[model samples]
Target chain A: MIELRDVHKAFGSNRVLRGVNLTIPGGTSMVIIGGSGTGKSVALKSILGLVKPDSGTILLDGEDVAKAERDAFLARFGMLFQGGALFDSLTVWQNVAFRLLRGSLKRPIEEARAIAVEKLRRVGLKPEVADLFPAELSGGMQKRVGLARAIAAEPEIIFFDEPTTGLDPIMAGVINELIREIVTEMGATAMTITHDMSSVRAIADHVAMLHDGVIQWTGPVADMDASGDPYLDQFIHGRAEGPIEAVR
Target chain B: MIALAPLAAVGRSTLAMLGTIGSVALYAAITLGHILRPPFYIREFFSALLTIGYFSLPVVGLTTLFTGGALALQIFSGGARFNAESVVPQIVAIGIVRELGPVLTGLMVAGRVSAAIAAEIATMKVTEQLDALVTLSTNPIKYLTVPRVLAATIALPFLAAVGDIIGIMGGYLVGVTRLDFNAAVYLRNTVDFLETADVVSGLVKAAVFGFIVALMGCYHGMNSGRGAQGVGRATTNAVVSSSILILASNYLLTELFF
Candidate 1:
């Protein structure tokens, strides 16, 4: 389980996260939905210690994330970034096998490569694509490669940031299905932040709507529509006007 | 109060500059500290060595060669004004070995390597690859900055030595072909007049310049703002700052050596 308590983060004068408190139960997928620039990414990053919060505590499995041994703490989590964030210099397999190739998870080169190929196949990429660089692949293929890399180490927790943001509807559906299936099969704690309603419907066990630097509504996905919160209704229905202003 | 606005602006500018200097110094100290820690990436180190050293050969060689030939001609003409044209070989040797060779090589590498490093690193940061490295249990400083800085620091002295030899050869070529000078005598004069200390000092300077170049590149790159404009600015700053630092440090090193 991951829990964030009164997390606050600010960049200069812009307070991106203001006293955000949320929790995800073990072995469940929690999808955070928000409009652009509403601190969704910051909130996710805070849990991973990628973005440090000003005056809050993030606990992973009851351990304070900030105080944990960095490598050991990070070893339990895998993240797929919004932009894929694949290393341009590395081939797809090398990117997937990056963790195994070095540090405490070190493995023999051939074994690591073989595992990378397997993970690539698991992500629905051909084994032949392993040798190609990230630039050579299409965006969807790159996202699959990113996904393959994320799960290569079989982490206990996984983060998906805007997983289906740029894909065509079909590809988006495929990725969404893949994410839901992978999370279920691995039984990993999954935290995903995306605005795609389709993705929220497909992958979310619990849905949280972030607005005004705070979670405006959070509950099981089944309760989202009838949550009786105007902000939640306005956001879910994509209304430009309501208590939440559209313009910055 | 309005009349003093210019003075306040100057004060702000000075403070900002001091802040940047402090940040860079702290960054360098941290990088040096990390250099002694474990988890050294040998493959990354060798890759950097090849990039910073071997591939830089042609550019360093060409720059020094042309400079040396030009130095010989200038020195010969200047010596002729004092009826001392025979001093060309001695002057050219000392100048190339002690100063021009390393400075020129450092400047040329600063232009080529520093800009490339900054641009590549800035792009990685923009693309979140550095963050991805962290998520993979890899320290960006350990994997990226340390290897490149170590390679440049270690490789540059050797490059300067090669530049010194090529530079002298350039002078020899110019002397034998262009100026009607005895080939054997020119070689003998250059060899006899050059001191071991001269070459050693230049190599030492090259090492320091290499450190500065790579450090500036990594620093600007890591601190770059977002987008294409940010990357372009970082690249420009890396080259400009490294060049200025190399020239400034060369003067200080010359003073210490001489």
Candidate 2:
């Protein structure tokens, strides 16, 4: 389980996250939904220790994340970035096997490559694509490659940041399905942040609505539509006029 | 208050400059600290050695060669004005070995390697590859900055030595062919006039210049703002800062050596 308590983060005058408090139970997919620039990414990054929060505590499995051994703490989590964030200098298999090739998770090159190929196949990419660079692949293929790399180490926790943001609807559905299936099969604690309604529906067991740098509403996906919160309704139905203003 | 606005602006600019200098110094200290620790990236080090040293051979060689030939001609003409044209080989040897060789090579490498390093690193930061490296349990300073800085620092002295030799050869070529000087005598004069300390000092300066070049590149790159404009600005800053530091340090090193 991951928990954030009164997390606040600001960049200069812009307070991106203001006293955000949320929790995700073990072995479940929790999707955070919000409009652009509403601190969804910041919240996820805070949990991962990528972004440090001011005057807040993030706990992973009841251990304070900021105080944990960095490598050991990070070794348990895998993340797929919003832009894929694949190393352009490396081939696809090298990117996937990056964790396996170095640090405490070191493995033999042949074994690592074999595992990378397997993960690629698991993510719907052909083994032949292993030698190709990220620039050679399509955006959807790159996303799949990113997914493959994320799960290569078989981490206990996984983060997906705007996983389906730039994909075509069909491809986005495919990725959404893959993520849902992978999270179930791995039984890993999954935390995803996306604004896509379909992705939220397909991948989320629990939904958290972040607005105004806080969680406006959070509950099981089944209870999301009838949560009786105007902000939640306005967000889910994509309404322009409501208690939540569309313009900044 | 309005009349004093210019003075306040100058004060702000000075403070900002000092802040940037402090940040860069702190960054260098951290990088040096990491260099003494474990988990060295040997593969990356060798890759940087190849990029910073071996591939830079042609450019360094060409620049020194042309500068050497030009220096010989100028020195010969200047000597003729005092009826001392025989001093060409001696002056050329000392000038190339003691100053021109390393300074020119350093400036050239600063323009080439520093800009390349800044642009590549800034692009990686923009793309979140640096963050990705962190997520993968790899330190970007160890994997990226240390290797490049170490390679440049170690490789540049050898490059300056090579540049010195090539530069002397250029003078020799010009001295024998363009001027009516005997080849054997020119070689002998150059050999007799050059001291080992002269060459060593230039090599030392090359090493320091190399450190400055890579450090500036990594610093600007890591602190780059977002987007294409940011990367471009970082590249320009890296080259400009490295060049200025190289020239400034050259004067100080010359004072220490002489």
Candidate 3:
């Protein structure tokens, strides 16, 4: 389980996160939904320690991850960035196998490359494609490569940031299905941030709406349609006219 | 009032620039601290050496060679008034080792490597590659910054030394062929005048400059803003800041050593 307690963050005069708190039980998918600049990404970054919260505690499996030894704490989590963050200089296999081939996890180059190829194959990519660079792949393939790299280590916890942002609806659905498959298969605790309703329907066990730096609504995915909160209603439907104004 | 406004603007900009410099210094110290601790990435270090040092040789060698030749001609012509042409070889050697070798090599590498590292990492940050590394149980700093910084620091001095040698040779070639200096005497003068301290100082400068270049690239890329413009800005900043720091540090080191 992952728990965030009263997280606060500010940049100069701008308060991006204002004492936000939330929790996710293990072996479940929690999707955070929010509008642009609504602190969704900031909230996720805080959980991951990418952005240190001013005063808050993030607990993973009931232990304070923020206070834990960074590398060991980091070792348990996998994150799929919204941008697909592929290393352009390395080939697809090398990128996927990056961690496996270095430090205490070091494997022979051939063994690591083989595992990279297998992971690529798991994501519906051909063996031959592993030799190619990230730039050589299409957007969808890049995302798939990113996904493969994320799960390569089979992390206990997974975070997906705007997973379906730039893809076409068809590709988005495919990615959503793949994410669902991986979370279910691994039984990993998953937290995903996305405004894609279809993704919420496809992958989420529960949905949390972040607005004004706090979770405005939280419930099972089925209850999201009847969430009743004006902000949640306005955001889920992406309605132009609602209690939540289009502009701040 | 107009003059006052401009002065106020200048003062504000200066303060902002100072803030940036302070942050960079802080970032450098933190990275160095991490570097000293455990989880060092040795593979990345070797790879960086190959990329920053070995690959950069041709350009540094060529730039110093040409610059040395030109400096020799300029010094010889300037010295003609006092018939002090004998100073050409010594000046070329010192100038190449102290200034041109490190600064030009740093600038060139910054132009080539800094932008490349920043763009690659910023694109990763934007694209989710760095997050992927984190997920795979990898520290991005250990994986990314360690190798690049280690490579640049270790490789740069060798490049400077090579540049130093190549530059003096360039001056020697120019002196013997164009300036009518005897080849044997020019070689002897260069060897006799070049001290261990002079060479070591330049190498140390190269190492410092290398660290600056790689660190700037990683820092900007990791903290870069969103979208295309942010990555672009990071890349530009990395190159410009690295180059400027190299030149500025070169001056300070020179003063300290001399």
lDDT of each: 0.93, 0.93, 0.86
Root-mean-square deviation of candidate 2 = 1.0
- Per-residue accuracy of model 1 over B120-216 as CA lDDT, tens digit each: 9999999999989999999999898999999999999999999999999998899889988899999999889988898899999999988998899
- C-alpha lDDT (0 to 100) for residue A25 of candidate 1: 99
> TM per model?
0.99, 0.98, 0.89
**TM-score, candidate 1, first chain:** 0.99
lDDT of 2 by residue, B6-102 (tens): 9999999999999998999999999999998978889889998899999899999999999899999999899999998888899989999899989
Residues A115-227 of candidate 2 have per-residue lDDT tens digits of 99999999999999999999999999999999999999999999999999789999999999999999999999999999999999999999999999999999999999899
As a TM-score, model 2 comes out at: 0.98
Q: Kindly report which residue pairs in candidate 2 clash with one another.
A: none
Q: Which ten residues in a row have the lowest lDDT in candidate 3 chain B?
A: B128-137
What's the lDDT for residue A188 in model 2? 97
- Per-residue CA lDDT of model 1 for A1-248, tens digit only, reads 99989989999999999888999999999999989999999998888777889998899889999899999998998999988999998899999999999999999999999999999998899999999999999999999999999999999999999999789999999999999999999999999999999999999999999988888899999999899999989888999989988997
The prediction achieving the highest DockQ against the true structure is 1
Among incorrect, acceptable, medium and high, the docking class of model 1 is: high
- The segments of candidate 2 whose C-alpha lies over 4 angstroms from its true place after superposition are none
Give per-residue CA lDDT, model 3, range A71-120, as digits (tens): 67777777787878777778999888877877556789999999989889
Instruction: Return the candidate ranking by DockQ, descending.
Output: 1, 2, 3
Candidate that beats the other on lDDT, 2 or 3, i.e. the better one: 2
